[model samples]
Target: MESWLYILCICLILGAAIGFMAGLLGIGGGLIAVPALLHILPQVGVSAEKIPHVAIATSLAAIILTSLSSARAHHKRANIPWPLFKSMLPGFVLGALCSGYISEMIAAKSLQQIFAVFVILMAAQMAFPFKAQSNRDMPSAAHLFIAATVIAVIAALMGIGGGVLLVPFLTWCGLQMRFAVGFSAATGLLIALFGSIGYTLAGWDAAGLPDWTLGYIYLPALVGIVSTSMLMAPIGAKAATTLPTAKLKKIFALFLTLVGLKLVFA
Candidate 1:
């Protein structure tokens, strides 16, 4: 009981940080949550082989609330491109729903390595920001569907909201950055929702999951994380306007780089 309490405390703190950084840096909490959970789950009786699966599933579950909040904010601000979002919604749902089953077939170590590579790439993108040139027109509906499907699949696999991939893709297709961000946030909610469901279904009959689990989602950790993350996100957003965000992003990028390397070599 005491150990459980200690783990919950750590999760709360981790969630607070994830929320703040997400707001401040405009990054997904999963990047941090996945790695942290990889460490925390073992202490809660999660087997070594199942650690990555649980971590990714739990992170995706935790994202639902945060992404909803973000999407609502963007909608209120008229940031989201409703037509575009609507057009791609089906594809996003389909792809995210497929990712859970796909991941179940892959080895845990391979997933960790894939996540590590993703983290390293994200860190590099942060440290050296890339401005997408808006040179092309929006593609046809079929093309949009295909693109959205691909993005959703990758995002689900990585336990992320798909902003890193979506924003750039939108911008490259002549959408403004603000609209791209808003659209990405809106789509992230769908990814989280459907992805969580997919993961839950995929792990339902799996062996060796710890107690208090809804399939792969760890209830205690999810509760602890969502409790603080929701409250802290607004505060962090408020801070972003006043903070030296460029410098902070660089520092955070370095931190991500280290975390990625640790995962790769661990």
Candidate 2:
């Protein structure tokens, strides 16, 4: 036996690093975690045929915990925009729930390619950093619903918290960065929660699943990642002020690009 214990060790290391980077760079850990899990899960005996769906579901499960913590902290600050949050919930929930089923329908290779593309796009956004304002208030309820739905679907598909899309959209709608971030944190909770559940349901009766899996969500990986990410997020936040994020972001972005390419062609 190759000792599945190494999987836990790998998860802890991945979690700790992600927590530090999240704190250090303010990016969601999912972007990193999805790729990391894809690499690590096989060590624990997950089949390559199921790796993509498994990675995504497990990442979303991890996000449920992380996003909840972030949402709570942001909520304490009283910065979350409740009205917007309320309006978007219907669409967000719907999209997230559908993601698991949708993912199950797709091939693992296709999913990996999508994730790879998504990762590259996210890296580009973060690394390059662009902001444009339309000088308008939030859109109509219908528009908001539609936009939220799109974002939520993608977030579920990518196993991310949707902050990459949400934060910028909120900021563009005239919300300050701080408020936008807080709002996005709250929203991430919704995405993670429903998204993970959908995955669980989607994978409930899956074939050849590992011993500790709940649908596509890998239990050991989730435990290790959630435990460490929570502990390190604050540390990352503290270090953010002192780090040369500009340079770091560029380097990390390049790294993500390579990772994305590897996933696509691997």
Candidate 3:
């Protein structure tokens, strides 16, 4: 009982930090959430071997709510390009579903190794922001479909919002940064919804999941992290007024690099 309470506290603190960073950096909360959960879940009695899978699954599930709220806000501002969003929707959903099935078949250690590599790559991207020189317009339907499918699959596997990649891609293609951010927010919701469902269905009959888990998603961890992060995001946004965006992003990049190292060595 004491240990559970302790775990809950840690999760809350972790969520708060993640939320603040998301708001400040405009990065997806999953950027921090996945790594934090990778550490926190095991302390709460999740098996060491299954920790990576559980962390990723739970992170994706939590993002469903976070993304919905975010996308709604962006939509209210008319930031989302409905046509572009629609073009990508079907492919994203299909890829997420396929990735969910694939995740279940993967070995635990292998998944963690993959996640570690992804984390380092994301950190590098964050530290050194992409400046795409291309000014091409949005691609045609067939091209968009294929592109979205690839992005969604990779995102589902990495347990991240497609925003990390989508935002830069859109900007390179001549979309304004603001619109790209908004579009990324909307697309993230679709990815999370389908990916979460995939994980749930894929692990439906799996053995050895802890109590309070729905398939691979751990309920207690999700509840704690999502609730706190959602509450803290606006706080972080408000606080960012006092700091430089570039500095904050650099700090976040350093943090990710450290987390990536930890995961790789552990």
Q: What number of clashing residue pairs does each candidate have, in the order they appear?
A: 0, 2, 0
RMSD of each: 1.2, 1.4, 1.7
- Residue-level lDDT of model 2, residues 120-155, one tens digit each, is 998899888878555679888888898899999999
Clashes of 2: 2
Q: Write candidate 1's Cα lDDT for 1-266 as tens digits.
A: 75567678889999999989988887899999999999998998888878898999889999999999889989999999999966798899999999889899989999999999999999999989888968688999999999999999999999998999999899999999999989999999999899999999998988888788898888888988999988888889899999999999999999999999999999
Q: What's the ranking of the predictions by lDDT, best on top?
A: 1, 2, 3
Task: Write down the lDDT that model 3 would get.
Answer: 0.83
* Alpha-carbon RMSD, candidate 2: 1.4
TM-score of each: 0.96, 0.96, 0.93
- Better model by lDDT, 1 or 3? 1
Q: How close is candidate 3 to the true structure, as a TM-score?
A: 0.93
- List candidate 2 stretches off by more than 4 Å: 1-3
Candidate 3 residue pairs that clash: none
Candidate 3 positional error at 36, Å: 1.7
- What digit string (tens of lDDT, one per residue) describes model 3 on residues 1-266? 75557766777788788788888887877777787777778766778767877888888888888899899999999998887867788889999888878887788888887888888888898889887746787788888889899999889888887898888778887888878889999889889889888888887777766777787888877877888889988988888888898887888788888888887888
Question: lDDT per model, in order?
Answer: 0.91, 0.88, 0.83
In model 1, what is the error at residue 257, expressed in angstroms?
0.7
On TM-score, the stronger of 1 and 3 is 1
* Candidate 1 ranges beyond 4 A from true positions: 2-4
Better of 2 and 3 by lDDT: 2
In terms of lDDT, the poorest run of 10 residues in model 2 is 1-10
